[model samples]
Target: MGIRTLVAMLAVALVVIGALATQESYKVFMPGLLQGAVLTIEIAVLGSLLAIVMGVLAALARMYGPAPLRWLATVYVEIFRGTSALVQLFWLFFVLPQFGVMLDAFLVAVLALGLNVGAYGSEVVRGAIQSVARGQWEASTALNMSRPQMLRRIILPQAFVAMIPPWGNLFIELLKSTALVSLITLSDLAFKAQQMNQNTFKTIPIFTLVLLMYLAMSLVVTIGMRLLERRASLGLARGKAA
Candidate 1:
């Protein structure tokens, strides 16, 4: 299997080399587009982190908070998740100033992406938390652990372990959604590709490269998430063991 994999990799390398050899021009358009790609990653990482925090907060509120807090959480989740993400971005970037709440384009993009994705993530968090066994909650109660303490030390750790895979999907979705920032004038991966296409009129090669770049970025996210999943699963196992 190792040798087969090695040969397969070599074959792909040769193909890429042959393509690059034929079109050394990929270097010429890469700089500006690559800058946009970097910005896309920055947005994705920040947005994903913010979304995760919002998700957990909202999920907890819906699950265990007082009635008003739960209602607020439900309202937030419904409004954001039901709306079109592109419209949300437009409203933030274009309309907020009239209402005296102006944020810069980049900040608006980040907030839009994070909040939109977080709405969906709230459902994921809710499901994961609810999936935990009732016995764990009873056991925590029997041990005299407070609600906050029990969630922090027992429920969240287990729920987070289960949430990883779904969270990974949400992360990828958030990453792809960053492309829409281009519509609001924030330079991102898709925006850069569009710029390259306009300048060079090489739409095929430009978008092909764009496809590969997204694939590469998604692979990186997938691998990182897989490692996290392993670590979380190990921690969960150890907790159960002890």
Candidate 2:
């Protein structure tokens, strides 16, 4: 058979094997799977909230601040983005205790995940803000609008509309990255999956359940984001028409 056919057959065989393995241990796997889903949801929600806050702040500082402040923001973003997330997590978890700053594993994970994703998300926020037309700024200034007034009344509303789609994508990424928190013993989905596999010696079934749970959660987030995007676009369209 051709290479393509051989790969397809291999994939089919793997799927069949996975099906058989999962069926054999469904009872033992289901509870841990549910627990893992809840943990994953918790981490995603908390981390995304922190990330959004940090991202908006970072973007604002970078876009509107003095040169020194802008440089600082740029450095922050680069450092986080440059390093591996696993190293950041380990440092936060292990190093902070030396300075008399002790954060629980969950908190450290949330902070690290938020900071890491925030660096990337800030670029999205900055781009969205910059995409707002220069004419809008000039018109606002012509109207004798102060900087704060222009930002609040004319700029932010438009920028927020543009930011939503990219923010949604970043949120999905934040969801997946929460898996790394497992390394710090946060008892999130990946952690629980590891625990289950270790205790039950049923690696395949446990991992399969965890995979399905992640897929299901990601699907929900994707659907929600699509609906939000549609709503945001529809609102903008209606306003333009009016």
Can you give the TM-score per candidate against the true fold? 0.89, 0.85
Q: What's model 1's TM-score?
A: 0.89
Clashing pairs in 1: none
Off by over 4 Å in 2: 1-24, 237-242
Model 1: per-residue lDDT, tens digit, 1-242? 23345345545644663475367777666677679889999999999988998998999999999999999999989999999899999998888998999798889989999999999999999999888899999999999999999999989888887898899899999999999999988888898998778888988777877776776677667667766777778846532321
- As for candidate 2, its clashing pairs are none
Error of 2 at 4 (Å): 30
lDDT of 2 by residue, 108-169 (tens): 98899899889998998899878888999999999999998999998888887777767878
Q: After superposition, how far is residue 44 of candidate 2 from its true place, in Å?
A: 1.0
Assess candidate 1 and give its lDDT: 0.84
